[model samples]
Target: MTPTITTFTQQRVTVADGVALNVAVGGAGSPVVLLHGFPQTHLMWRHVATDLAADHTVICPDLRGYGDSDKPAATDGRTYAKRTMAADVVALARALGHDRFALAGHDRGALVAVRAGLDHPGAVTHLAALDVLPTLDMWEVMHGTSAAVGFHLYLMAQPPGLPERMIGASADAFFGHFLDGWATDPDAIPADVRAAYLKASREAVPSIVADYRASATVDVEDDQADRLAGHRLRMPVTVLQQDWGTALGFDAAARWRAWAPNLVHNTVSCGHFMAEEDPGEVVKALRGLLSR
Candidate 1:
């Protein structure tokens, strides 16, 4: 029962640096690339992509180090950095003949989308981040008891060997923890799709931890530098997030305002897996972004 979106063609597009991304292209109008988050593949967008395909050329790609994409060894934590992942998708889009495209991502993919907007302003026309804050703002807000809610972030942020070994030892438990905890309804992700995620993540332990490790170190530095230089996402940006800020005692919208000046930020009723739990809302928000 692996979910399938009909009328989509899948292919491997070798990016500029020789990383071949497994991409799914469908629909027939303006291009819009969708990036999947951790513990999932482009399959997470099954519902939304099929719906958007009516009016948009939906491009769904498994982000590097996740799903079927190339998982290069981490060299000084640079391999899995958002900047590097962002470049992969941008190159993928351009190689597919999309010079400029609407971009939407959930979780880790959202981080990449944010970086793509910041790094390649000319290429990403509209930016939508589903269920995440900027890297700097994220680290800044996770404190005290509230920080416990993001325990995995802290765990994966540790030095590479231990985190990789720990997660590898209980790969299913590790990946399944997020799958179970983050969803408002466990059934939002069908059992077959859940199995696919667990299988892919189990095989990608080292690279997966590397992605989070880079987030804590290099990603933070990059975001801090951007803030100091007053660099914000120049394109119209929409953020759909659960109200973790309220539960964690911070103003999420205000925080996003600093990074996205032309921003439309709102809280979603669904938990972290907004795309699966509430695809229609995600679609509406993305449509709003496209209109902007």
Candidate 2:
């Protein structure tokens, strides 16, 4: 029972780097681009997008390495870096006639959204990140025994080949682990949508792992450079998470405030799949960002 967006029109948008992203467009107001997280497609936004569409022109894109979007072979993880993926989103919005747009992303997409806000501050009017920390802060807090929570991050950070091969060997189990483990209500994803996620992940093992690998390496360098330059997101930013920071022994909001001067950070009781598990709260947070 995958959710459907009957009001939206779909298109294949070729970005500046020639990667064609599958995007869904709907509604009629100020533009807002929504980026879906790992192992899920733009279809993940069916609930929240439909709600936002009443007052916004919502654009949801399947990120380059996931879903039906173009999955280019990784050349040392650079291709899947959030920097590159962020550019694709900016290009997608520009191609569709928006010089600037509001942006929101969850999970891996949150990483991309953060990069987009950092790299193209002038283009992203408002930013929202769901359930993720900036790459540098993420790695900083995830150390010693705490690192075990993000074991996949370490596994994928390895030098390609082996991680891809091992994940490919049991793709369903690997993908299902996240879908099941992260969601408060596993049924929130529904069977068909879960099946779609599994299928896409199984096919894009290498590219998917490259995306994570880039977060550990190149993405960190980029974030660190920006921090050194004293750069912060200029737009109003909202971050909603499940209080992993409390469990991980870091002030999540304080950490986010370092990069987002004007930020409204809150922790939710919902699982990592906040958008699906608690669309009302997610929508409320996005609307707050939009209003700002």
Candidate 3:
């Protein structure tokens, strides 16, 4: 059986018309919503959420297109856009009685958190993004051979049909590849959690592809618009990432500084799954961000 965060209560919360999210909420005091990344579910925050729940009302939801959440068909370019996902997050928070809350996301969810911070600044009191750059900066930095590391991004960004079929063919191997390759510590995600991730990704191929495809198209357009309008994250921001910049030939902090003015950027010595690999560090960074 799949494990859940201790003491958290699970519920289905409607966040949009005809869409509801499977959410695990716990704790009291000020609210803090945690979003999980690609190939994972709210379960990714099992460690970090439990730690934060000691003092904060922790909200962990499987993004609309992942895990047990409702997966609407990608009818248009806007369907899986980070903008839509961000809105869902805001609505989720509002429904849970938080007019304002701290927010944190990992990987793909970080993209949504950044969009939320930009689109709904007043709703997000503080923001923390883990292991990702904004969509625009991500495309700008990846070039030539180095871009090969992100081949999956290009693959999922294709015009829908083919990408879905290809990934769906061997979903476990495809999704499991990242789980195995990105973690510095192989055991950070134990057998049960790894199995759960593979299971969820295996079942949500079309929506997952739609999510990534949106990043390549509409998501980038939204980021471009935000950049041109001189919009930056107004809330106190914290960014934790590996030293990908040194390998990719860009200044990671400088890249983040462009989008978030009040930022505390730290280079962590961990894999992509830092929250699981180093939950203490992730919790510490989030606590510091909230305190700001």
Candidate 4:
């Protein structure tokens, strides 16, 4: 069966201090920004964006260094910090004439969403993070061989040049591995989407590695700052995670509660790509979170 996609065109918008980005905007009413995870683009949210667009304006963008967006050379200051990425979302929302918006992000996008909420608590109305814990917790919990689930976190967190070179060598294999491993069903991610993700990741290897490196370095600093300042998410927060805690032996909800004072967290019976693996359930969770 040929699927029909609500064809949206590309529009370039500048953010991250003049780093131009390609964004896909559609629908009307209250604005909701959907951020896609690593090794993928805004296309990851194609199904959810269309469904939410029925009643609320949906703005999905190929985040900087991915998809149709500008792939700037990430340097000392211009690297892919979630803080900078979150700021890009702020600039994107403001450009779209939304002073306050609801945000939902999956996988790596969820990392950025949490940063956005903590940084711009006034601008983000509600926040939902799918399938990830905060960077600090994620790093601290990994040890010896037990942390094999996030092998890339340590690999990409290395000195910038090595990860970029290695990943670039076989970008297709690296990106395709996640698409294949995370999804419960092979058909969940169509071949075209898989191809697009691989192409984008290959093109954005430097920035992607920089993003992960930041997670291990500057991102950790930012999270530590928030922790020291006792900064908690002011907006209502929701977290939908696979039962990694049960599998890995950590209280997922308890960890989230430590950071978010106002929180509703749940574990879903799905794999890592919760949205793609279980779109209907993801939508229901979003509807409930946003409704609150």
Candidate 5:
């Protein structure tokens, strides 16, 4: 089905120094920022954003170099570090007149959301992370065969020019693989949505690769340092993940408890794309977290 271009509040944000991001806003009241996952855009929150917007202002932004945002050049030592990217969200919310907000992110966005809660404990009143572990734990849990599940982790983690060049060669297929592999139900992601995801990802290949590259290098180290220092998530936190007991090895929520103190974890019966496959469940889980 084609998107009818419904009633969405849209704008662009020049956040964190000067990076511009395309943002969609709606609803009114307390603010809640929805951050989409990798290989997807802010549109991923179509099901949940408007509902939350009814009770709280909802802000959705295409991260730095993704979606219709500016594709700025990645300077040496200034690539897409999660910390820097996380700052963009804070700035995005501020750009929309929100100094504090509830924040929820899915998959890659979950990583960013976790970082935001850690980096800006005061600004984020409540936190929700969907379908991901902390970056440090993600890398630490990797083993022989377990590593195979995320080939792109190594691929995109490659040094500088290599990953970008190879990914560019077949950008469509590269992004499509994750789009296809992650969703348990195709209807969960309609065709137009799929097309938008593929289109946004294809155009943002270089920055997307840079984002992943930073995650493997700087992002992982940063999360590790925070963990070593025993800095847990201070805000109310909700984590939604696949049980992963049979597929990945351990319980997903159990691993997350190591980092989040005020935490509630729900193992949903869905694939990694939990938000897309079951947005209502995601919304319910988030409401529960925010209420606490």
Candidate 6:
């Protein structure tokens, strides 16, 4: 059987235009909304969520295009844009009686969290992004041979149909490749959890591809506009990442500092799935962020 966060109640909450998200809510006190990354679901927070729930109200939701949430069709460029997804997160929190909350996300979800912090600064009191650079900086820094590490980004950024079909044809192999390769500790994701992630990704190829496609197009445009307007994250921000900048040839903290003046950037000693591979460290970083 697949595992879930302990002591959390699962529910389906409608966030936008009849689109509902499958979410897990637990604990009391202050509210914190946690978003999961690509090739995975809210289940990625199984350890971290339970730990935080000891004192805070934790909201863990499957992003619209992944897991059990409503997968709306990507009718236009805006459909799966981070702006639209960020609105879904704000709506999810408000529906759960939180006008303002702390927010954290990993991988693709980190992209969404950054958008939420930028677009709804008043709504997100504290922000944490684990293992991802902002969209605009990500596109700017990835160059030449180093770009090969992110081949999936380029693959899914193609013009819709072909990318979707190609990934769909051999979904498990494609998704499992990341699951196998990106982790320094393979045992961090147990066999059943790995299976669950593969199943979710396999079933949501088109929507998943649409999410990445938007990152390449609409998300970049949105970030660029924000940059040109000199907008920055107002809340305190925490960024935990592996030392990818050393290999990618760009100062990760410097790039993040451009958008987040109030930032605490740390290079974690783990893989991309740090929340799973090293949940204790992730929880520690998050707890420190919440206190700030």
Clashing residue pairs in candidate 6 are none
> Which residues of candidate 3, in runs, are more than 4 Å off?
none
Give model 3 RMSD, 1 decimal.
0.9
Clashes of 2: 0
Model 4 clashing residue pairs (backbone):
none
lDDT of 3 by residue, 158-267 (tens): 89689999889988899999999999999999998999999988989999999999999999999999999999998999999999999999999999999999999999
C-alpha TM-scores of all predictions = 0.97, 0.97, 0.99, 0.95, 0.95, 0.98
lDDT of 1 by residue, 64-93 (tens): 888788888887777888999999989999
Which one wins by lDDT: 1 or 5? 1
Note the Cα lDDT for every prediction shown: 0.90, 0.91, 0.94, 0.84, 0.83, 0.93
The list of candidate 4 runs beyond 4 A from truth reads: 1-5
Tens-digit lDDT string for candidate 6 (1-292): 2345778988999999969999989998899899999789999999999899899999999998889888999999998999999999999999999999999999999999999999999999999999999999999999999999999999999997899989999999999999999999999999989999999899899999999999999999999999999999989999999999999899999999999999999998999999999999999998999999
Stretches of candidate 1 above 4 Å error? 1-4
Measured by TM-score, how close is model 4 to the native structure? 0.95
Candidate 5 lDDT over residue span 1-292, tens digit each: 1131247767777896567888888878888999999888888898888777778888888888788877777785456888888898998888889899999998888888888989998899999998888888888777788789889999988877888889889988988898888888878888888898888888888889888888888898888899889998988999888766457676667678888878898788888777778889988998888898
TM-score of 3: 0.99
* Cα RMSD of predicted structure 2: 1.5
Write down the worst ten-residue block by lDDT for model 6: 1-10
Error of 4 at 276 (Å): 1.4
TM-score of 2: 0.97
RMSD of 4: 2.4
Better of 1 and 6 by lDDT: 6
lDDT of 6 at 52: 95
